[model samples]
Target chain A: MVNQQRFGLSLVALSCLVLTACDHNDNDEPAPMPPADVSYSYEVTVQNLTQGQPLSPVGVALHGDAVMWETGMPASEALEVLAEGGDNSDFIAVEGVLASATGAAPIGPGSSETVTVTVVNEPDTFISIATMLVNTNDAFAGITGHGLSELEVGQTMMMVLPVLDAGTEANSEAAGTIPGPADGGEGYNAERDDADLVSFHPGVVSADDGLMMSALTSAHRFDNPAVKLTITRTE
Target chain B: MKLKQLTSIMVATGLTALSGFSQAAELEITVQNLTRGIYFTPILITAHSPDQQLFNVGEAASTELQAMAEGGDISGLETAVDALSADTVANPAGGLLMPTAATTTTLSTMDGNTALSIVAMMLPTNDGFIGLNSWMIPEAPGTYTVYLNAYDAGTEANDEIRGGGAPGAPGLPVPPPLEDLVGNGGSGVTSEMTNATVHIHPGNLGDDEAAGGMSDISNTVQRWLNPVAMVTVTVSE
Candidate 1:
């Protein structure tokens, strides 16, 4: 708490120094006072809880109250691409996103990643996070349209998230389908083969467990509560 | 040791009620089986003292728990909790809770019963069950959602073959509906109980064949991800 106060004081001091420097250099016409911009910063940390499935790069977004996805509803094209291929490029750029951040690389099982996002002058901010379980056909884990407006600075929120099947692609476990290292196959395909609506993932049926065409093995099996997500308001 | 905590909670409740500060809570609970192929036998939802746990992870399963986890029997558990004057609703869904099905029941808990626990056996596996053990009821009246994972009772082996439903049974109990879905005999999955204490279940290893696989359970149909159950609790004002 003391450190935060000290940091705020130093920022004020630095701004004062900048204003003084401008006054001395441009005495003829003083620089116009910049608009007061208050920044809200959030640090989002995601931990992979699965035994084998590696999480794709985490995508964090600050947006309005619109839900990114819902149960029984078809996944957006951005979500479908990310859930199928573990490519979150379009997901982080979805409409209505005010600010976003993406993890540098895939988070291995039992690993965690932290991404910090900052938005200026956006007080009523809502957070959404999305990431794919790279070993599955189109399985993803995330929370959509969670309100963060009431989260006071320095407060922390934690949640254990459940996995969701994007339903855009079939959980075939077939060769040349999964994009994880276990398969080294293709990622997102535009075709909607399976149930197109999002729902809770039923889990992987690996080849060791009787799926004859599956490229996955028993090690790829996982249960619910696949990720532990933590959010902290830094500023 | 845990029993002492329960006594203290009871005493505190007595004092609060005598001081004219009764905190009776009314709760409406729903349990949904989210698995794709697993079936839940007779669910047991109870609201007891804070320290009274229906089941604890990493601990030994009680005899009552063994009976319920092995077979679809809840009479022993019901009797045990009834002795504590707990608020319980056993088998809200008449019988088996099929895949993707749900059961709802309302419980008006007396003062001091502020913890909730729910348990049910998952069929097609030996001693695999879903559990929510002693979650403290929030003081604020609001709706809360909790997801549950599959647990092993640690009393029986997970040999996925059709066998008796009795405690210490050798194989899985193939109910009438599951008889056709479950396969015939080859050999048992395994006769070993690696973890004698309750733990997270290492899911079933089903095979493709029906009449002549290593086990009877179907691999393609019975597999599930974590969070086999979702419990929604609504605390009323």
Candidate 2:
């Protein structure tokens, strides 16, 4: 009788297990499935070429059909903030960005950093990267709205980028205005005291160049094509 | 005899069709001043043969180039290129191309003339001019953009004062539009042409004092970076 009882209980348990699985299948709603994984990756390496200026944390973005800044046009507030303050948070978060990456730390003069970004199957995307020359008020260097759709995996593209004036702040180089280690005074003041249109940077006029109030020296001076960028599509 | 004549005529037609390598190109060229405060005097755009060059860096400027760089004169260079059978558009802007202004002209380039060059003087400087030297025209049909830099003709000392526009003059030639805008100088900046060959300009050094500074140009207003102008070429065969 005991053996028969054990057998009966085993049969009941098996029936319950089968019925529960059947009930789960027969339910009106099914569990949600995870989406497919499709990724396109790029590795961007930036080199700071200035003698005294340390570049801000580099921000690289992949977008479609947009320019972050243009010559003769007013800079967007995001660009102004980055140009003035050496901050890239707001710039990277600007709308219409598909994928983005930021360097972990500021790149010092002659130093380099690599930041990798991944997007979902966006092989035909335009890439823009920007970083501020930390010694100046509104000088930044990068390429904007450059087409990278033709760059295939394993192919590398290299460019020497020219410095551009954001035209948001005057290049006063005053003692208490520069944000770099040379001054350590201020960054990202909201005043638009200079020409509001973007242009190639005329370069900084340091104290050595007869600007009385400038805190910068001749070592802080820089010319065109301030930075070099190397980009490779990974996967 | 009739069949042989027909064959010869077909052979001639085939040979004519295969000789399409020297086709002419129609180009619409536009130059836009990208400076904030500088002005470009009358421009000279030319399409010439590959072996010819209006100006080359590291070489001394020709007298014709010096004339144009100092005085905004294109007639001398125009005459020289005309002798070479080049297609040219002289003074497309008709006068000074002001800051951030653009001017366009069309030219039909003849066969074997595949290079394009452009030159225009930048005002308020002794001999600074925007130059595009011997850029090869593309055979494909498309629009191409090029950025140009400022070059010093090394013909005159950059004495930032008012003076004559002659080829050997020392001071900047202040036009009527720039008379009051430029300053009066107490003394000249320097009486030397250091490089004495066509090279990149060292840019202007204008002080804030309008009447008594070493330079008459404005330090803040008249300064510019490289890539002073943008040229676009639209080509169609």
Candidate 3:
């Protein structure tokens, strides 16, 4: 009798399970869907326009109204690191950055690099891009506080960038001062032995010019408008 | 636009619309010294007809221009531009614009004046001046930026000495601010004007010694890079 009673209970349970499965039909309202994620993306292309100067890995970031470096102000430590050494790691990681990207390798003279950075759910209004000239003491070429809100998808803007001295290390052109492949010397020294204020770079003076102690040659010299850059919005 | 008036009279005069007549413009201007150490003398900003040029590259500089370039004397240029009926802002900084500083001024141009020019002598160098030659003012109402480069007047020899302030002076003028800043007892940098035509300045070659060096200017104090001046012009329609 007990076994029969248990069998009846099992049958009731099976029917209940079947009815429960049927009650929850496909017609039931689907769980609320999540909102879609939106993204903004940009591509920064930099061309090393010099004849013999190779650029360090390109550093690019989306920032606010604040400038990365000013003409007369002292360079930040992040800027000093990239200017002295050919390292973009610290520059792209600077404070107040929204989104940043860096080129994979050094860009040679007459060569170019294009890097893309994307931000989720918001538009990037300002973009700052910088790259070291690699062949001098603390010289870099860049554009800062460039407004990108006006840039539409597939629209590109072009500008020529002038080289600037970082004012961190002295422009001695000594045998062991430069950190490029041309010199293979020390990089990112903490000493601020130079003018201590950022300014346009005086064209490199080589041993052939007047500085008899310079390790550089005339081939390393460069004039203004050192690089041509184009920024485009991909998304 | 001034040309609009000419266009209206073209039919009565039995002619088509003629070019070269420019519209007057109101401009709010700012000049910033971008150098880390260089100073600028009295700046003269002018707006004139397109035909007038204050200083042209690849040509010999005018004597008036030489006076201003050598001794920071803008009176000659001031008087000359005034004769042309050009609108001007003279010495907006009131004195020497120090390194990495700026000056602002406003100019209301007369009819048919559409070109802009700016000039200032860079101190601590002989015959070295910062110049912008005849940039056409765009008819559009917007802000524009231009960089002015250092130019050699090719009139006086850049002796790097402290000499007279008249025309054909042999050295740079040591203003009060630069009196103690500049060094003495230097022989000279060069005595020759190799390029007697207006040209991009062969940059100052300063020496390390404070006294008795090849140049009186300090290698670290007075040297500068090109594009010494940054000009911003906001045109209001």
Candidate 4:
């Protein structure tokens, strides 16, 4: 009871000190000021949940309802560049993005990386995060147009994301086709040969499973809920 | 016609149609193919009691469930559910539900039917079907989404070849649309049954060969990951 009373008294004293400071400022005939612009910042942490596939540098953005990718729809050039290759340069340059950030390096299996995005004045209502599996043809995992506007400061949101096939490139899993540590070969190609629309990734069928030309083995096979992503509003 | 008949009978006998206090619910159900390449045969959707499971894992499938999973036919299963007084919507899509395609239907369930179940055989497989075994319908009105996995009924061998769809058949049923899509002239993948009970499918082992491989299914075209289907149910007030 004594500690509670003392804490209450200190709070009253602190308010009084602030009031005195405001009174001193009032003597200078201060003009009414408009509301200050606040910079909203969010930190997104992505953990790779695949066994052998390493995740590319996670690309994150805060934007409007304009989504990065849609299922059963052709992927935009920006998304193709990121999903086919491990490149996020074009994706971050997409228009209407309030703020964007990319991880420094690839996140391996069972590893995590945190990327921070900040926007000033604009309401960052939508959050989009995307990254490639790097071992497959065009498999990527992330969420797009996820609402974060209702998120308050210091609040965090968590979601387990499923893998999506970009459908820009065929999942041949051939030698010199994959871009990850397994193949260490080609990245993005302009040709749209496979299904031209994005959908859930029909997992990698390795060479062990009758895919003779597949550069991948059974070790590279992956399933749904490939990555665990957590978002937090820092400021 | 059956739903209308039930309504008319209740109207003619006008003495509180429900057996006791009403436990019925109106539902809007939507099923979508989440796979990139696969076709769902005529879907069998139903609302039944809590204890009436469609198919249970680690248990031998009922003959009615076996027929639906082996062939694309839901007649046997439909008849069995009718005997239980369950409300059902058979083949809402009218035909095959293609990859990424969705089908929606409304179900006005009877009293005591508080659980929902749906089953459909996926083409290109012998006894594999997408199964949602008796999910409890929520009392509150809201939208719910559930992902469904492919199950092997253990009634037939997963030969992955063209054959008749009768019960105890050795291969898959190829309808007219999938006639060209599925290849022919292949040796069987496996003739032995390791686990002779309803269980999670180990997925198809398709080969890159088009004509003369172990499995007629193309490795690049027919393989699927877990969660082959997505079901969204909206309980209306």
Candidate 5:
């Protein structure tokens, strides 16, 4: 009688297990899936290497495939704004920008600033940074669309930046036109003057060099490689 | 598969032995002037032993190098390199390599010649020249590219005036083509070479006035930054 009673209890337990399994299959809810993994961040440090020219507030952006500027090509409207007036608003809001960061203040000559920007995406991303030499008419220095796919964790790359002219404005060195402390004048205008294609800057000819109406002096002059940029992949 | 691997090894060994037997190499070199306004004086391309240097930064220049940097004379440097049994080509362009121009030359380097150097004076300046210091030539047969920068010999003052081309001269040499471009009758810029050793050039301080100004160079035209020339070398197997 005891063995029969135990057999009956075992049958009841099997029924309960079969019923639970059927209930689970009949439910509409799906199984729990693994979590999605996607994210990236970079730390960029820009050092002003000039003697007297202070760089404007930097504009940093992360994108997938678009370039901010190209050598021997025309500067886009976003680049023109940043190069002329030290305003990075248009550049930060550019299309394809995954993330953007702007320095709180202008980086002075011989000083450095670090900016951090993060994006939640795959590893196939690029970073671009730009800033104007606020003392000059249209001179700016930065890099565009540097690939970050191979930047391993804790890896850093150092690049020397060459000065470029935004071709949207003339390098007239006229008074009341420069936007930096050298002139405190107008910044960006829609007018397209000079060569329309971006090219290496031919340096500024200050008033000391006979640009009589120029707000700049000999001290504002600069040379190639006006900025040093170091980028490190932190995460 | 085993036979294929053995054949590959044998070919590699044969090639290495052939390279060891052939000690001479033929090199085809092309140099491009990338600037828009600057003029490169007659260039001297030399392939010498590993011990020689055409120019050294932060060091005092030899008299031969000074002559080429201050003036557009390569005779001194040519003679010096020749004394070392170096393979050299002088003035491949036959004259000034104009702005945005290119010149090419071919040289056969004998055994023990392993390094290469090129030098050319930049006109409309006092002591500026495009320099490629001693660089090792790779033993592997391939093409290589090198960018050259302008260097100041620190031997003469950069007065930026128009005068003569002789060694130890006071001012720039007005070549025929550049005479029309350079200004005239300018007061001197300076008469001092502050750092009397090879250093980066403190670029030209030009004036706008074409005639009768503080500088014979046009501020808008005569200035340049680093990397004035691009050199391409093709090594024959």
Candidate 6:
């Protein structure tokens, strides 16, 4: 774990050096032109904080001033697809996106993945990333459009994020409903049978706990802060 | 540019003058229950010297803290903080703080009071309480936000059955709001607390059967993850 974190940090530093060199040369050639390409490279590392839940393919996006999802509001079709099916294509295709990146594969329990997203000409952009606990119905963890403008060079911030329910699907935990290895079931159905507004997930009710038809067990249950996210600005 | 510099200088001077006159500070605090279905008993909020602590992880709970954790009583903790000359605000909600509700209180710190602590029992549990232990108050004047997690006192069994509310109570206290929500008439979950010290709560093991199950708490509606409450504090110089 320690070695992985160190390698991730070094990659971020190398990217920043490249971006800084590009910005310095652009300053001399600009005249009433577009904004300088003050690029920023960010390394986002996520750790699964759950006992048995394995997260789906992670989605990372950089947007200007818009949010992907909000509480007490109807979820966008892009968000609904990702929440139900763990697909990142629709979510990454959202408008006003400055840059985006997706993890190569799903992250398992006690595992960590470091993704590097580089946005050009948008150093003051807001970063948002999310991944679903594929064992549950619609639980996802990520940060919204948190301001990254004040992040100094080589500075890092660590935070633990709470799980949120997309409110597009009910947390039934039934057979053939979950998309992870726990059930090997279908993903991304276009239906809004549950609460439509986003809210905090109340966790799964496994068979050991009382849901007789639930495919999940006590071992598949989880709690808050299902993921630990660390953001570092290299340039 | 000159006006900007002058404004900065005057602001610094005013801050210095205000710090000199006040030996202590008056704080306005607000705590919000962010969960959907948890109940917080009367809360115990205190500002004390750095030497004192209400509770600590991996340490045994004091008799006063145990009383507040096992049951919903705060008088013992209130008196303990009073003896230490700590500023305290007891039962700010006047009653139980229901789910998705908020409460506010005010506490004035003494000259040496530099640390803050808050504790409150969670309903439908034998020995669980929301805890914030001895956080150092910042010297700078600003608004700060802190999140609190549920801690097990480890002094009693979490049978989850409806029973007494006293300090040494064996089962959960079925308050009015939770009376219809929690289950009833079930065999106990466990009689032993493996770690006999304050620790992160393993969370409630609620069952699905409403009338008869191993636990009186409903598995779907009663369980919570960490960070059940949020505390916002505004400091004045």
Scored by lDDT, model 5 comes in at 0.85
Clashes of each: 4, 0, 0, 0, 0, 2
DockQ of 6: 0.21
Reference-based TM-score, model 6: 0.75
Chain A TM-score vs. truth, each candidate = 0.86, 0.84, 0.84, 0.90, 0.84, 0.84
Candidate 4, CAPRI quality class derived from DockQ:
medium
Candidate 6 Cα outliers beyond 4 Å, as residue runs: A1-35, A47-52, A64-81, A88-98, A110-121, A153-170, A184-205, A208-211, A222-225, B1-23, B26-28, B34-36, B57-63, B100-106, B191-197
Regions more than 4 Å wrong, model 1: A1-54, A70-78, A89-122, A153-163, A167-170, A189-212, A217-235, B1-22, B34-36, B50-53, B56-64, B79-84, B94-102, B164-170, B175-181, B194-199
- Candidate 4's residue-wise lDDT over B15-120, tens digit each? 4543343488999999998777888999999999777888999999999989899888899999999999999999999999988788999999988898899999
Native contacts, share recovered per candidate: 0.42, 0.19, 0.31, 0.65, 0.21, 0.31
lDDT of each: 0.89, 0.87, 0.86, 0.89, 0.85, 0.84
Judged by TM-score, which candidate is best? Answer: 4
Model 5: residue B31 alpha-carbon error in angstroms:
6.0
The window of 10 residues in a row where model 6 chain A has the poorest summed lDDT is A24-33
Q: Calculate DockQ per candidate and list them.
A: 0.30, 0.24, 0.25, 0.57, 0.15, 0.21
Q: Per-residue lDDT for B3-119 in model 6, tens only?
A: 999999999998677555435777889888755457899999999877799999999999999989887889999999999999999999998997657798888898778789999
Candidate number of the best DockQ: 4
Off by over 4 Å in 4: A1-30, A122-124, B1-23
Give lDDT: candidate 4, residue B158.
82
TM-scores for candidates 1 onward, in order: 0.75, 0.83, 0.83, 0.87, 0.69, 0.75
Provide C-alpha RMSD values for all models, in order.
6.0, 11.9, 12.8, 6.8, 12.1, 9.7
lDDT of 4: 0.89
Q: How well is candidate 5 docked (DockQ)?
A: 0.15
In TM-score terms, candidate 2 sits at: 0.83
Instruction: By DockQ, rank the candidates, best first.
Output: 4, 1, 3, 2, 6, 5
